[model samples]
Target: MAANIVFTRIDNRLVHGQVGVTWTKAVNANLLLVANDEAASDPLMQKLMSTTAESSGAGIRFFTLQHTIDIISKAADRQHIFIVVKTPQDCEKLIAGGVPIKTVNVGNMHFAQGKTEITKKVYVDADDKKALLDIAHKGVDIYIQDYPGEKKTTVDDALLSKVQ
Candidate 1:
């Protein structure tokens, strides 16, 4: 059975204090899944994030893109999973891999040299824009909100046009 995905968010800083405590509590999620290729391959990152999640009273797991697709696909229905990815590209992959993601919350994408600010917490470059637009085209709802209580800025044509 597909995993009970209660929340899916794209935050560069995955499984941090805000996510592990605030969002997990907000969503009432039991599991926190960090679906990032770099984090999955690094033992130090996994350990650190695992410790954080445990401290927050939520079970945590780090998986690569393909591994996330494989594992989440077979997860039990009772496991309320909160998925966090670093980029929109990764979010797109999860949907393509049949993870059953319907809505994506854009939490934080830190400023980079080539990126432009979309919201106070969201900055996107060309590639990021393309991936996000593709995801939107596939009928997925995308919005930017830093925290659970904040207002969400929907990713629409007007939003995409502002990237350039």
Candidate 2:
């Protein structure tokens, strides 16, 4: 059975306070799936994220890109999953690997060298834009929304133009 994916978000700072509490509550997700290769392999990160999720009364699992694809595909329907990845690239990969993601939320992409600021919180480079565009092409609804209460900005041509 397919996992009940309640929400999917791309936030570089995965599984933080806002995500652990606000977004989890908003989506009513019982599982917080941190789909990142680095986080999945690191013991310290796992421990920290586990503590955070426990505090929010949700179960958390850190998985690599491939692991996420494999596990989520076979997940039980009762698992209300809130998937969080660090980049659109990772999100795209998961979709390609058969995660059944219908919508994606661009929560945060911090400023960095060679990346243009598309929104106050979202910065994108050429690769980032391409990944997002690919996700959009795959029929996923991609939108910029830092917090659940904030206004949602669709990843339309206008928003993509800013980075181009």
Please tell me which predicted candidate would have the highest lDDT against the true structure.
2
Per-candidate alpha-carbon RMSD to the true structure: 1.1, 1.0
What TM-score, to 2 decimals, does candidate 2 have? 0.96
Q: Write candidate 1's Cα lDDT for 1-164 as tens digits.
A: 56789999999988788898899989999999999999989998888888878877899988898998887878888789999999999999999998889889999999999899998888999899998998888899889988888888998778979787
Model 2: lDDT of residue 100: 89
Against the true structure, what is each candidate's TM-score? 0.95, 0.96
Considering summed lDDT, which 10 consecutive residues are worst modelled in model 2? 155-164
Colliding residue pairs in candidate 1: none
Q: Residue-wise lDDT of candidate 2 within 1-164, one digit each (tens)?
A: 67799999999989888899999999999999999999999999889878888888999999999999887877888889999999999999999999989999999899999999998999999999999999988889999998888899999766798776
Q: What lDDT is reached at residue 83 by model 2?
A: 96
After aligning candidate 2 to the native by TM-score, how far in Å is the CA of 41 from where it should be?
0.7
Instruction: List candidate 2 stretches off by more than 4 Å.
Output: none
